[model samples]
Target: MAKPGSSGDEQLPSNEERGCEGIRSRLPLTTLELFFVSVIFGMFSITLLCIYITMPSVDQKFLKIPRTVEELRTLTEYVSKYTDSYKPQVLAGFCVTYIFMQTFMIPGTIVMSLLAGSLFGIAEGAALVIFTATAGASSCYFLSKLIGRPLAMWLWPDKLRFFTREVAKRRDYLFNYMLFLRVTPTLPNTFINVCSPIVGVPYLTFLVATMLGLLPATFVTVRAGVALNTLRSFNELYDVKTVGALFVIGFVSIMPAIMSKFQSQDSDRSHSS
Candidate 1:
């Protein structure tokens, strides 16, 4: 008795179908969005260039991709030889590259962090890594919130569900959960940055949690830069021991949440009784 042009499933779109359609329609950036993204990137690049030019270092050939230890070693040695004269330019270059990568969700920031250690030593390198990582995350968060949500949703549908659920569950202790995610590497930072806005995490909470959570991993990676000469491969950077330490840190960060959950259960039991 159905209409000739209609099927049982064709009455109206389900929520799931609507979501899929929304994602498909939203994935592409609008003309105004593209213009904004390009303009921001251009301005950021220009600012970095101005900072570099004002510095004593006259060379800007310091930026290159190093795929192997030999290339990295050579690059490190060259930078070290002129650290006194090129320090400002090198610092500016690293910041620009890191922010650019984070904003655009590009890979290879690990290489840049490693280079930071090789060129600037431990303390300075770790600080640089943390600062740039946090700043870049902030940039990505705002960008995704405004114009990149569809792409983020499409790229990380499953992780997006998990993030949204966890964020909702931990309304009071959200920062701890964020720190846990950051420390354990359960999720990629880029995905977190992009998906967070869509999932309803507040910008301030994301910023604070990112700054706090990235410290241990940043230290490990930046510290590895101190030993870049001995490192055989990028895989070797996160050996079992390092991963164990990160897990431990992650566990500690979430302890408050764990305790709160127990307390909530206790209160619920009391109320039920």
Candidate 2:
């Protein structure tokens, strides 16, 4: 046995210490990465500024990010008036805003989806939401590829590990696994957007999964937007039935992976026999 003060008795670094060390080791690269992120933010800001400058004059009071049902209704009323006259401008602004929110992992996209439905009706709104959401998710995936490692490690170490392990186990069926994640509440979309690249999910897989898997949920929200005036609360958006439907969709998405796993198990058992 080692003596109490011997080097052999020294404990290995705890997870927290190791994490800090890893972060410190990447400090220089992290600084450069963050500079790039800031540059991207600046470019988006300028684009939004240009869109705003070109947009037709409207009451500034109605020009706010709707955080509540009442706010959404009010903005919907005012923006609808301008949408018809300035459809292209309105669409551009909406897409830019939605994409910016997603790329930065900002919240309130549900509100944006509702607004889309309110302005564009169900079919167009769903399509718009899907396109912008996919674009945003894609943007985030690439951004994460640049600087996501330390941030993911810092913000969600345990979740990152779990995601990485799951991803490794389902490499053969990665598309299905990713689709399931997008369809279900198993992981938050924002989290998925930020950590997907960090966990080694490919851009093509991420893009397709996001576009298709988000359809069901996006449709629900957009449909609700058409009747935004009637919504008493956000809780009404994802009631039990809706949540169950989403889960069913999620299960369907993963069915292929599940079948493959069972088939492999049976094959192994047969070989053993």
Candidate 3:
């Protein structure tokens, strides 16, 4: 039996009410958002597709871990030939080509950095490497932001999973973490640049971290460049000794936080007094 004026139903929302609720419930998406997202992801797709079609042997031919010193030497020499002159035309051409090399996942970046050192001297070489690496990294970050998570994951499956997990734990010290990633050999820095955006790292954080984080590696490669002939293998760029030195630097990088912690503790005690 129904009570008077009681349908005994979940209060059926009016059509108008339902329509409004539907608008509220569903996520709002504008054409502009879709267009921007499409453009971004489309760029990544295009880059990937182009690479896949043209460079099917990519992982083997190019990205295969360069284990031997001869491979590194051969590569440095090839690039060095083009860098024979310090003319503006050659420099511009090198920048443009290197930018593409980095953005498109082409290999030999370290050799390229080393070449800069051999040609430009230590200070200028380091500056060039840091500048170029940052620019290239920023380009990848923007592309990932546009492509969103899906494409980023597709392109860098294993690396993204590890990076996302790590970034989550150190969200508070993002700059330090970014520095660690760039300074150490754990993550290929170019990979980090592209994936960070997909994992939601901010642009400023990426920029500053990139600019500062790449310094040590740049210095090491540049120093090695001073004696480029001695560097037979790519590993020579940053061997165990260099890695140990960098870890010490990473430890020093965390010192400011230790000091800040002590300062806060002292302030807390004073306030209790």
Candidate 4:
């Protein structure tokens, strides 16, 4: 029953086999990966619970995460009442909550930054935001290092490949490139945080870039928080002018790298000639 020019044992896969393979490919993680995720989630939960238990008594309704300007104002008003008496508790809770959101790639950190401004003014608020953002980004980087390859590949195969290739081309100028990314909105921070370690970006470079690169944006958000009572919308925080300024800063950060790249090319041409 062997077909001409075919081995007797050779056969096309059945439809069921093909379907199973497709299903496996579509799965985002394996059992072990899920286990790792659960462990990290559990640790974060415990830390948050501890922070909550130590906090002073307050109406539970006012203790939710703020998603909008109005909601942020409400929570800020309520929390401000206690900051004087519970300064340490307030700072601890805020830092923990901010870090929690960042570590898990959650949104609403903008609102948290606003809250920092509302509570601590520009100087302290910017410092707090930068510190917590770096810590959170670092946490995400390490977590991704452990179990992010599959998830990143599944979610962003093209982006992952592109980032890896770009990083490869700029190993000598890695810090400048990274700082540019952080300063500009060229890529999502969450994507950068998760993919950096996967692409072999060292922790020091990631750490320093995150701290310094976040400064300008952090100052803008925190300053807006100072005028929280007059603030209308999130869009007001980042207009065209602000965005252009950020881009300019980002460009300046990478200028040295660009100049070096050009110099290297010229040197290569001279040698070839």
Using lDDT, rank the candidates from best to worst. 2, 4, 1, 3
Worst 10 residues of 4 by lDDT: 7-16
Query: Candidates' lDDT values, in order?
Result: 0.79, 0.85, 0.65, 0.84
C-alpha lDDT (0 to 100) for residue 234 of candidate 3: 74
lDDT of 1 by residue, 1-273 (tens): 112234323322243355655666563667888899999989888987787667664444655667776777777887787678767766777788899889988888888888899888899999999999999999999988888655655565556656666666676787888889888989999989987776667788899999999999888888889998788888888899999999999999999889989999999999999
TM-score, model 3 to reference:
0.66
* Model 4 residue pairs with clashes: none
lDDT of 4 at 222: 99
Model 2, position 162: C-alpha lDDT score:
74
Best by TM-score: 2
- In model 4, which runs have C-alpha deviations exceeding 4 angstroms? 1-25, 271-273
**TM-score, one value per model:** 0.85, 0.89, 0.66, 0.88
TM-score of model 2 vs. true structure: 0.89
Q: Per-residue lDDT of 6-125 in model 4, one digit per residue for the tens?
A: 331221113223433453477667899898888988888898778778876768887677767898889988999988988988898888888888878898888999999999999999
Candidate 1: stretches off by over 4 Å: 1-27, 51-62
lDDT of 3 by residue, 6-66 (tens): 3312112132234444444543445766687567557655654554454223233543323
Q: What RMSD does model 2 have? A: 6.8
Instruction: Give the best candidate by lDDT.
Output: 2
- Per-residue lDDT, model 1, residue 6, is 41
Backbone clash count, each prediction separately: 0, 0, 2, 0
